[model samples]
Target: AQSVTQPDIHITVSEGASLELRCNYSYGATPYLFWYVQSPGQGLQLLLKYFSGDTLVQGIKGFEAEFKRSQSSFNLRKPSVHWSDAAEYFCAVGHGSGNTGKLIFGQGTTLQVKP
Candidate 1:
């Protein structure tokens, strides 16, 4: 079965510090990976995605991720952390062809920023 894992349940960082959120996936074939952020009581917002081609992808809000096929990982990173960036981050994998836009998401990583 296809699945996504976010080992860290929570992370804390000071403002201006660098941040990294880990994500791993298990699938039989190449997977479409995505990173989304959700604020309290709000819908998810796409941060970045990797459908194909380049291994390194840039996203909104100064975020970036690299797709590693060998490790089956697509980790999200930010060079500088902002208080507004504090939210719940999720890593999801698409069901591939034949499926709608449904995605299997990881448990989620909660990011806390200190001023």
Candidate 2:
């Protein structure tokens, strides 16, 4: 079965610090990976995605992620953290091609920033 795992439930970082959120997935074939952010009481917004081609992908809000096929991981990273970046981050995998756009998401990682 395809699944996603976010080991860290919460992360705290000071403003201007670098941040990294881990994500791992298990699937039988090449998977479409994605990262999304959800502010408190808000809907999820796409942060980044990996479909094919380059292993490193850049995203909005100064975010980037690298797809590692060997490790089955797609970790999200930010060089500098800001208070506004504090939100719940989710890593997800899309179902194989030819199917509806259904995604299996990780538990989620909450990010907290201190000023």
Candidate 3:
């Protein structure tokens, strides 16, 4: 079965420190990779995505993700963190089919920013 796992349930980073959220997927073929961020009392926002072509894809809010086929990982990274960046991050995988909206989400990782 295809699934996504976010090893860390919670992560803390300094306000100006770099951040990386790990995401690994188990699938027979290369699936669509996506990263979403949801703030308190808000809907999920698309951070970045990898849908073929480029291994490294740039996303909104100074975020970027690299797709590694060998490791079956699509990790999200940021050079610097902000207080407003603190939110729940989710890694999702979508099987290439009729609907791209259908995705399997990971448990989710909550990011806490320190002063």
Q: In candidate 2, what are the lDDT values of residues 1-115, reduced to their tens digit? A: 8899999999999999999999999988789999999999999999999999999999999999999999999999999999999999999999567658889999999999999
Error of 2 at 60 (Å): 0.3
Worst 10 residues of 3 by lDDT: 94-103
Whole-structure CA lDDT of model 2: 0.96
User: Of 1 and 3, which scores higher on TM-score?
Assistant: 1
Give lDDT tens digits, candidate 1, residues 5-115.
Answer: 999999999999999999999988788999999999999999999999999999999999999999999999999999999999999999568778789999999999999
lDDT of each: 0.96, 0.96, 0.94
RMSD (Å) per prediction:
0.9, 0.9, 1.3
Report the lDDT of model 1 for residue 114: 99
TM-score of every candidate: 0.96, 0.96, 0.95
Which has the better lDDT: candidate 1, or candidate 3?
A: 1
